[model samples]
Target chain A: MTDAAAPTRPIILEAALDAPPDLVWRALTEPELMARWLGASDIEAKVGRCFTVRPDGPVGEAPIACEVLEAEPGRMLSYRWRATAPGEAAALDTVVTWVLEPTAEGGTRLRLVHDGFPVVLQGAIRGQGAGVSTMSAVRRRQAPDLRRRGDGRAKMSSGEVIKWAA
Target chain B: MDLFDFDEAILEADILRALADPTRRAVFEQLARREMSVSELKAGFSVSQPAISQHLAALRGAGLVAERREGRFAYYRAEPQGLAPLIDWIDRYRAFWPERIDRLKDVLKDIKP
Candidate 1:
């Protein structure tokens, strides 16, 4: 069984944009607009729609594969992103969620959460170690640890602090 | 080999893949408390003895755990240093997001109403 005490910690980023929620949403969801600000992407704002984001440079031309998980116009958006380098059989999958709240001053308060990384890693490790059958239980147990580790305060069974190496 | 010469992406991927299992994580955490032999570790989990050995092998492969034989029995302990690459990878995003947001702000300004 998974540990209940630890929860997956998402990478959160917040920004207050001097624009309305609809404007901010369009910038984030529109491929042309997103390419100008974020990266070159052909993403649509519909749940289950798959897309890709190809950024220019030495990072190679392998695009980031994405699938929209949630899409609420002018409010919230979430998607699963996977990056697979050429010649590698395995891909790193992560989830990115965006929450937009309209401010009293008419600006947009944007919060972004990138999650599922640690669990993905943990699932791979567990499958290799214990076999694939136990992955769900292991993932449930690992969620809390991922969340706890994100905040930089991971605790062991003995209550000893497990500090991340700098 | 110089540590700086290590390919971080490859190393980080390998490390993450190795420690991704819950059983291995528990084993690593158990070892973090104190070094233990295979039989001793087996007592803490409901899995078969062979399963524990498999978990240990993965942990060792990732360099997250180390083994030392004392006579017939081999004891394993957590090697915290092995986690450095994963931590570094996470830290990069922590630093990268703010700067990206600033760039986004500039992008927003250029957009017409």
Candidate 2:
């Protein structure tokens, strides 16, 4: 049986930073500043550049392999992230987009969207089995009524995967 | 390195990959509800018996299912501990961003005029 009303939303987290948009953008793009906040990363602010964020201390030790998709200085930054592991051929890729907007009160509203996780998770897992005919039959049975909602953000509230931080 | 130094994402991905198939997921769900032997499990699905065995083997390799042999039959059941790595991976991100953002604030404050 399929879940009829299941929402396929991406995980989105937002925070209002006390810094200006430029400063917030710099913190996100600059390696030194990013390392102080995110993790030990070799991030470049330019588009199409690949980067790696190594685990720092206890936060994350597994390296995150990312490729820059969009890099607009002082505005938005988006990348595809996947955790590298040994012997896994097909790693699930999720998009992480950071949108920075300057607040009238001199703060930056940072909206972070980690998108494509639900689909990616489903796709990655679905590709593992040898029962293609059975899988496709199930997919065909379930595909008609399923529809993606606006911006794929509304479904995060109902997602059981990642519990948002308090 | 210490015993805890191993990356759990590898195991998490393996388990997710193992259960990704619709048939495998159904099989695993059935096993979760009640342990079943190959013949019993094969009866519910339309796939060949060899295919079911292959799916079970993948599940076993991923540590998501455990098997016990009794006489000529092998019974398989879902392994709950096999899910711990995936749970921990998700939990890590739950704590990761909020804490990092807090630290980012400190970084900004220190560098700001």
Tens-digit per-residue lDDT, B27-109, candidate 2? 87667656899999999999999999999999999887899998987899876456555444433454555567778889999
What tens-digit string does per-residue lDDT give for candidate 1 at A1-166?
Answer: 1232222445666667898888888888999888876679999999999999865445433577899999999999999876654554233456888899999998998887776545323423442543333333433343323434565544433333333321
Tell how far residue A16 is off in model 1, in angstroms: 1.4
What lDDT is reached at residue A7 by model 2?
18
DockQ category of candidate 2 = incorrect
How big is the RMSD of model 1? 9.9
Report the lDDT tens digits of candidate 2 across residue range A34-116: 99988789999788999987647753356778899999899999998777566763233467899999999999988887754
**Cα deviation of B61, candidate 2, in Å:** 1.3
Clashes of each: 15, 2
Give the per-residue lDDT of model 1 (tens digit) for B27-91. Answer: 87777666899999999999999999999998898787899998988999876666655554444
- Candidate 2 residue A46 Cα shift, in angstroms, is 3.1
Error of 2 at A128 (Å): 24
TM-scores for every predicted model: 0.72, 0.72
DockQ of each: 0.12, 0.16
